[model samples]
Target: MSVDINNYNPTRVLVGVPYVNTVFHFIVGGGGTTLNLTDQISNDNSIGFGKGVAWIASDQAAILANIYTSTFSSWLSSQIWVYTQLPSTSLASTPTAIIPNSQQPIPSSISSELINIVSTPSGLVVLDVSGGILFI
Candidate 1:
């Protein structure tokens, strides 16, 4: 249903069968800066992937503010930029998740990168726009 990563290791390789209709939320710790969603392969040592959301430092606040104001258009626009501008070096592939049209709240003590995914009748909806600095 929900998973919380406290000390997410950037070096650790995450390998799994592609999921469908699943939502991933990478919550940031109080002292955390930003979450890097790079894919790592143990054998190849090639640090590159193309599927996940990496929230930058200020993105948490920016997204929250826009959502609070009920500005879905602006929020989606900004997200499009943020998702696409991610760097390609040693970075994971673009996320196959969807950004909810509404705001989903988490504890104030913690920040998070929410990723909603749905793949049943349709294909994966990976958000690949252009903007925001990818936290590598």
Candidate 2:
């Protein structure tokens, strides 16, 4: 008996590839220079303002951590993210931090960072505070 290889189709498998908008299976978080305005990998010692975090990068319109000491956009000033997939879900925005404020460290894990991702538009406000997303 011969089988049609092209007929092989799996929703979970196909939709979960390294394509655009494909959700990262793991969580995203980590502590690596918060007050940094540049995404340069060399300048990683300045991880102070919102420092000490780790995560496995997951699929979300915006990563919203709970590290808000003030208005949630003060401290660090800015942040950088290395996206696992291209053409990210963020339609209008570019790669950005999971949390809203570039100021404080996320109080919770990246998963609970946002109040509601199911209803969120794009441009995830994530919190990089886990090791899984970093490893996988």
Candidate 3:
């Protein structure tokens, strides 16, 4: 399933999905000049925010770690994994460093640099910071 926040105006937006015994996935999509996840009218906008998990903070470290562990068994797991693609050129400029917001312990076996990021004709980009790229 997908969620479109096109031209949606709100003071604050929050989306929560409760825990389930079965596998579950949530996806959010937004692009184009007319679509946006936030606006001047809102105090804050949160996407895929969760509670009562292994982590408690909304910072990048916790988020990434949770994603890494959940998606790939562990941050440095050798198994191949795939994640949502992002627009490589969507940002105003290339990011200098892709460090997490908070400092957390990551396995030394894990590589720190982004291995590959490819742009697609559909205006989407795939990023693989874990290691090699796995197209889906």
TM-scores of the candidates are 0.17, 0.18, 0.18
Q: Would you give me the overall lDDT of model 1?
A: 0.26
Question: How high is the CA lDDT of each candidate model?
Answer: 0.26, 0.25, 0.23
Cα RMSD of predicted structure 3: 15.6
Give the Cα-based TM-score of candidate 3 against the true structure.
0.18
TM-score of 2: 0.18
The candidate that wins on lDDT is 1
Off by over 4 Å in 1: 1-6, 10-76, 80-89, 101-136
Off by over 4 Å in 2: 1-61, 66-95, 102-114, 119-136
Clashing pairs in 3: none
- Weakest lDDT window of 10 consecutive positions for candidate 3: 52-61
lDDT (Cα, tens digit) per residue for candidate 3, span 26-118: 223343223233211111212212211111111100111112333333433211112223122121112222233244323455444323223
